[model samples]
Target: MFRYLASASAMALMTNGPVFAQEHDHDHEDVTLYRVFVGDHADAKVTAFDLTEPDRRWTFDTTGQSKLYAVDNGSAVVAVQSNDDAVHFFTSGISLHAHGDHADIEVTEPAAIDQSLTGPRPFHVIDHDGKVVINFDRGGYAEIIDGHELSHGELESTQLKQARAHHGYAAPIGDLWVTSVASDAPVEGDAAPSRVGLQAINADGAPAGDVATCTGIHGEAFSGAFLATGCDEGVLTVSDGSDGPIMKMLEYPDDLPTGESTGTLLGSKSMQVFLGNYGAKGLVVIDPVDEPHFRYVELPFRRVDFVLDAANARFGYVLTEDGSLHQLDLLNAEVTKSAKITEPYSMDGDWNDPRPRLAMAGDEIVMSDPNAGLVRRISSESLEEVGTVEVEGQPYNIAVAGGSGVDHGAEADEHEHEAHDHAHSHDHDSKIYQGYFDDAQIAERQLSDWAGDWQSVYPLLQDGVLDPVMEHKAENGDQSAEEYRAYYEIGYKTDIDRITIEGDAVTFYQAGKPLAAQYASDGFEVLTYAKGNRGVRFIFEKTGGDEAAPRFIQFSDHAIAPQDAGHYHLYWGDDRAALLEEVTNWPTYYPSSLDGAQIVKEMIAH
Candidate 1:
């Protein structure tokens, strides 16, 4: 079976399909999985695992203790080993491909890519658009690498330079790079110069616009269309404008006490809001559009770590020194839920000392407990400890990347064919449903609708017994006979040869062994295809099954209602939502009693 890898050539080939313009929201199955990467405080190693299956884990040895960043939308994780002056990339092996209406997901073994970035003190790693910029503090430049190329093991980068080295950051925005400017004065030893302001530079590293004053600018985040950076004066914001790059400062309200300023900012993906650290014991929710933008949330104790809920932007999570995990509501700027999860991790030690770090996995909050030597999972809604994964050393820095998406299985190549504008000709004629599917009378179906013994058609196609069927399709279809045969070779391939449905029980047979399960109707979904055709997936959830039996099974016949199924395509997986996302790898089956010639005749008749 061909596993989908996010390689350069594979990505290039994927772009050839037609973009899904519109999608109808309907009840569909989705498979959601997450991979979390954790950096040890004292060890030069990063551990990773699928949150649900922590027993099966992957580890990568780094040059020094590292800070992890989830980049390329979680397809890869960047390890910024500051003390070692080296940066490394690890493929999370979990990728989600969004197709306007739905997304396709592929999972493989996580491994270290060939590319590595080394310089003097690699500090900040920023991912924007589809590019990742790694800031080398003492090198006076940040290397901007394309996220796609990096996923494919490419090390090429464009350097965004400054006059002198400084503890600063730069982000790639459109055609220009917004970078921090350091003072021109010489520094002692490896110490960096103090930041003076921010400026936009062209691809050639020349100044693009006037430098905007941002004294002591340190932290930055992206909220909607705006990029906000922290400064002593206020929050420096930048956005792409018709004239050029628009840079402005949102000054802090005068009513705030002295020595109170936000240094770290977390932006919401679902809303245009920024959550920044206000002093030691307060969190500020900044609204860019409204006046009196700052909404301060007072905590019971000093903050240990905080993270924004990117999936559900309504809430944020904060861990205080009292070991309490508080859920912050962004809209109201209030602490909604709180629970003590770990032992008190005082804020009295060094900034880089072992402590809890926060990361989001779907709607759940994943926090690292260094003293406990464990990574804990807490429900965002209940604020309760749901699970934990043990680590050997102090789990310091952490990041998570994974989401719900459909797995198209081996039909990865078939999706590339969809990018074109060719009309897909089906063996069955469009007699019942025509034009827009909005008028189609779709409804839920019973297991009895497709009952009885069914045999996979893969062997017939492989043995050239289905050559006449391919020839018949080419005569009435858009593709050639050879092309249709090759496409079917992938689409109809399957290990399970026979499936028997009796009452609520279904049995799948491979070779001679049978795995039976009891199934219940889970509902159905009508999907609009890229070719303007629509099909229905009648879903079933396993009520009781053998250990190896799939948790979910869905059938796609040409029927949309209570008609008996003749031949159908079947999809089964543990993740119901993910199985619905799969648009390819449909293993088709016909009546087991039908001979090769009879099946060919039935195909031509359809």
Candidate 2:
């Protein structure tokens, strides 16, 4: 049956496939299933297609067009959360491909959990082993979905929440389940720990004790035998327990200042986890087996996207907005080399724009470039582009499962939680409000200077002049000033016209103008500028200034470089951001011809 699908796909490729020939033959044992699950832009529904063969041979649909965002195929059932607060589950095991020349795109017809989660929005939908965990602030609970059963359809929903919404995780061991406590405290960037206690679901599948509480790990996962949790101070490593899992904090060296890391991926082959630090784009490999130590490897570009392959622990791939794939060597602990797979994705606008994400299927390092609407399959060993497959919609995530596709029946350990609504009542043109005071000095009021709460992205914080981390004070999203500030708003009219979101980059046209942001080879520099080290800063050259030799205006450092200067935007601290401001303010302190004071006087007199 599978052979027919392959032949039909191959035959169809003869007419539509690229004229290019194979650089190398894919042997049989190398066969791996790489499913590119794409989510719609405005619709919120999801579609899945296979990459090993072209033509996307099959497809899977979601319930009521939820923003079919992330997937956890690890549990055999793929779950999608709707932007409308519906948690939908689908048996990934279906005869999706059907028989080649003809396609079933057989959808096992996704079913909505009878219990609506307290969510119009949910952040993370994770499944560890067979236990599925969902955290929805709108639902006002952290519900644990039972994965042990085949019929994931409403198996069980356990809600855990106290106040509004925040992100949490489920730590699943054989019989014991560790869930985060609910908290109402304001969270900055999905980095804060829950205030709720950690609940232990005993072997009997009952909530054993009261909220088991602590400043829980920012993110949790089972690394080999130890269930690991990330914290601001250090990591809390949980180990096997006769009764349940035990937790311990693994601190970094005192000299390291205990940098916090998130977006952790547990190793499938080793007891290691890959964490990207908020301070910079680097991987801190925590070797849990050995006395824990964070082996850091910094990449030139911020590690925007990453994937783990414990089998090939030697290296991992990072897809940066700069449009390049960095091959970071775990052993040497650095980005050894890089290759360009796509055009540069603009750093100009919105954060959720279609970007590529890297995932590994066995030894193959494949990247799903949603912007290009294609998958760039590279040879994991050679780091060379082997082939590219296009899937419609935005291929945001990819999950590989052992089973091809099936409709498994259902089973036990039912846990249910109260549901909530995650829908926000803000209008589409809602203005974004950043906090008042740039540098605690003045105001930058937008159309909201008078209108107040009924706004969005108001009094914009200009990204070019000042990079500020505005306070976020919103949740369960009531467009209140407090809630609106929790999210920042920036505007950019992008004309990514014809720019293929192919490899790591994109080439597009905006208003008939060509634009690109490829990776810079010359390493960038990190400078600290402000007092609390909280001031935001970056290396930016004014666009429309000069393309030949771009001039750089780094606020963190007092130095000004004209176009033709060669430098990269690496890292910068508050010190760099401030000291540069002080130096630039010299016209009031002391003057120099370089200060442009003389030119200003001449212009005024003229």
Candidate 3:
């Protein structure tokens, strides 16, 4: 797919005109500006098209065959040359802003190849949190380049080299670097190494320790703070630890029949899991923390490309060669929906043949059809074709950039109108409270803070008193309250994941379930439950500036009456002195059971 070149006449037809004019209309305010940078293998150029307006934004002329890699959340695209030893960066010229209720995107001039790096066989480029790591497999070295610097024509890089040369990958995690290990010995013929290991390099450019063995490790991905590298045996999991980075190997289940090992690994940002390609007709769902981590799903045909829904944690889209899009539910490990969007592009040619590539542009799934020289857009919500944009030559490698955001111009106008209509003001004095109270008196005050570690501590106030039956049931547990509390705290700290904020929605996947929260007020949000009467209300209040002690409160009718009906205080700190201060100085009540109090005391003592 990377071998096509443009003719002289065809190259002359492509224009460098302004893709988007500086016309800021109210209609453009709420609309998401989508840009698809297509690397035409046959044309040897990158074309930028505004999918929102359905127009060609601009075209970048690459001197040779290239492959495009999206970086900085699609704000930029890097075209790595296939015929030479060089890489180029193209700015999508789209800026996204979030204003809670809506979004605004500004489309500017496309910056083509503003900065580039040259090396021997610069092929693999991976974007990790805005840092682009380009691996020169043939040269046995990799360069980590700052994505922001590259966009501004500034070059900042860290060079990492292995002991021997092989086709491998590398990723930077804080001060440490994880890279694929080279083959121990050179093969006599053309056969490649069957197995390889991984090594960690410290910031000082020295090996941290011995290599971790994994048979035939190829692709790598990151979900939350966890990193997964696909291997023949299973998957090598890497996570940041207090000491450094910890590595573990999660093998496939013995009951599952073995096939070809996964070479491409895709991590879901919303969940602590990894999605991998199993051979040519299957998809593997892997959860590093779960027992029997691997779950395979058979496909109808060979997969063309797939992408996880950034806005919907539970949904993923897979475009097969049969010209159909299948929506996958990661929670159930099954395809819940499917739609045919294009003509069948059989997977019967060379691996490098121009086919289709899938990418998510906000709520839309963009698929590039190289054979048709067109890009198809499908709504992720409906799983139906929305629009299509035609490009010059064969549009092979495609990357999308843009999102919804509120327009500041419209917001300013609305505020101006509101000011003229009514003089709205807030009373800051009434919101602030200052006091000291004993634990008993504090319990009578309204609960304010709720952001902290909380669990169901039994003797769950049945009626207005602790239930003896539930209390005894809790006491029969294998682990003591102190032990369980300690263990829970450790796990909670280690599993520090985050949710994605898009418009009014905050979406994330937790405990194999999709969870979402919608913005309500300044310090309040609404959490929607899959099976519940009304969504729970989450109210956050900043009690003190010292250590920023913010309290989280959950209000729901379904909660246990009286005790949980009001605001429920969530305790997070293990400092006994701090806890005592909160109990004595703060006007709040600890509504936990007697055992809960004991657990808190033990945690504080430890």
Candidate 4:
């Protein structure tokens, strides 16, 4: 009878185990793990840990107080020592790179400081592309160094000086330098400059244009092609133009409460928006690209630390003083999910006290708990607690440095064949031609022949209208039939003076100064010519083909294509005589679908 009962129990258990078995199998699958790096100030050490593993991978002790910055897609980490007045770079040990369909991460021996930089009061460090810019507040100068040069022990550096240096910042973008402009007014009993201006320096170290003025200028952020500087009155927006950097002010809404401007701004990697702290308990989303540009989201408590989810363009993680992690949906501008990961840590203490900090490792969000001596990993997608690693001492500052890598074993044969094929292919050599025009009329005339858009060349005329030809007298007083065309065209002007293409990289120039530009996608490039608390972006795309002169379309912002088309187009080749004939017979040459005449009237009316 006992045997019979046992058989019946086994049968019943098997019938109900399918669901449990499926869940277990799903969780045990080979999931990609990301690595997290933490900087413990009190311990004077930096530690690395794998989120999926329980053991700590490695740790490095520093000379003094340390702040961590992960550069080159987590290939290395730079620790800025506050008291020591030096910065140290170390290999993260976890090497991550793309292969084909997937990514791979290699865990190697922990490396010591590969390079060291010494300066006075080195506070802010910025990584624009591979170049690192460190600002020495007390020293009143900034150092620009190349990351690749660190390994050769021959790093090239450029020193930038401020006007009257009082804890300011400076950055070098391409051939342009944007630095803080100190006020000339005398200090009144410990008060510094009430108003500061942003100054642009050209390649030759001369002023590019007039200083962009802003009162109480502070924090800075970059989105897409533009850089924004915050101020008491408004946000200063800067962009690259054909002539020089253009500065504009986006004033705060009249109905909004006063005394609430951000000094700390976080830029998004996927979207053209900025996340900033508003007041003490609120967060502001600044989207300069669209309508209702500024949106505020109120938090339950003051934010402890927050970071943009670079992998996910739509989400950001915010940790509040309540020890709760909230997922911010950038699209909806709301908190979509929340999870309590740690004990309550009040924000009422001194600013320098050890507090929780946030970092992202792939799809996982890592939060360092200084008081608990722990780092908790949570899944960004599900908002669930996944794992935790015990850390020694107070882990105040934290950064993550690993991503997905392709499996070598899975695609070894496929990659080898592709490599062999690429080795024998002929390479295409592309060159960039930059054109500068002092007058808009001449620029439009030049661009029209290349883009095949006669309407843009002559914005005031109708589709069937022809540019009038005038009879002129030559030097000998002989009558000569010459076409007299109006120079001024009705369109938004560009700040870009020239464009350059070297290999796959494309750069733009303004006032004979080169600005940093990146390929946004196929046939499109976004140029950042302005540098400072505020900067500018010029989006250009290649159109047409060998059948006609290749046309270049320049857009004011990133939004390109029809309905939301570009501001103008620049046509290649200077066939003025051919273009003149084509424009004269507009009905035969111009596209009937394009209502150029109506578009110009609407643009002018607006």
Q: Estimate each model's TM-score.
A: 0.66, 0.51, 0.64, 0.63
**Candidate achieving higher TM-score, 2 or 4:** 4
Model 2 lDDT tens row, 1-606? 000111111211111111111001111011123444545544455665555655544554554434332223322344455355656655443222211111111124333334444464565555454356676744545566665343334456555443434456555654676666557666676564454445666533467545544464465554445566666556666665777666665666554534445445444323244444534455666666564467766667655577655334456677776888877766555777788888786645675666676766544676777777777788666678888877676666555432121111221112121111212121111000011113433222211111111101122222211122112111111123322222122111112212222222222234445544432212123222110011222243323322432233232111122111011112212243332322111101101111233222221121
Which candidate, 1 or 2, has the higher lDDT? Answer: 1
In candidate 2 the C-alpha lDDT for residue 473 amounts to: 14
- RMSD to the true structure for each prediction, in A, is 18.1, 28.8, 17.0, 21.1
lDDT of each: 0.75, 0.41, 0.56, 0.53
Q: What's the candidate order when arranged by decreasing TM-score? A: 1, 3, 4, 2
The sequence of per-residue lDDT tens digits that candidate 4 reaches over residues 334-361 is 9999988889888897876889899877
Q: For candidate 4, what is the TM-score?
A: 0.63
lDDT, candidate 3, equals 0.56
**What is the C-alpha lDDT profile of model 3 across 348-382, one tens digit per residue?**
98877888888877567888888787888888878
